[model samples]
Target: MGDLAAVVAARGVPAQEVMDEYARTLDRLVDPVRHPSLCWLRESGRLGTPDEPDHDFRFGLERVLDGVEALARGASA
Candidate 1:
């Protein structure tokens, strides 16, 4: 993910745009058919259970992107 961020940054993409794409990619990865073991791990709590049921991907990705956005804001400030 870091490598992806670096590449996107090099291309002059806005931070929020990069984060949005990252979030979408993460969402895609959470598909059970595409990543059964990852889905299993999330469901089994190996990836840490989220407060909202069946929202592990959306919740986690939002939290991560939020943090990244905050950091970008702070840096710009």
Candidate 2:
């Protein structure tokens, strides 16, 4: 992910935008239903079950977006 971010940065994407997109991509990839191992891990307690797995992922993505938004605002300031 860091390598991908570096490549995007090299291509001239704004740093915050790169991070935001990366986080969004991760949100999509982290869907437990899409990955059987993740489901198994969650069921087996290896990953521990969230009250709402999807919501947890969305919350994390929102936090990441918020951080990126904060950085963008700071840059503009």
TM-score per model over all chains = 0.32, 0.34
Q: Taking the tens digit of each residue's C-alpha lDDT, what string does model 2 give over 17-43?
A: 655665556556677767877656545
Each prediction's whole-model lDDT (CA): 0.63, 0.61
Worst 10 residues of 1 by lDDT: 45-54
Q: Residue 51 error for model 1, in Å?
A: 23
Q: Any runs in candidate 2 off by more than 4 Å, and if so which?
A: 1-50
Model 1 misplaced regions, further than 4 Å: 1-5, 31-77
Candidate number achieving the greatest lDDT relative to the actual structure: 1
Compute the lDDT for candidate 2: 0.61
State model 1's lDDT.
0.63
Model 1 residue 28 lDDT score: 69
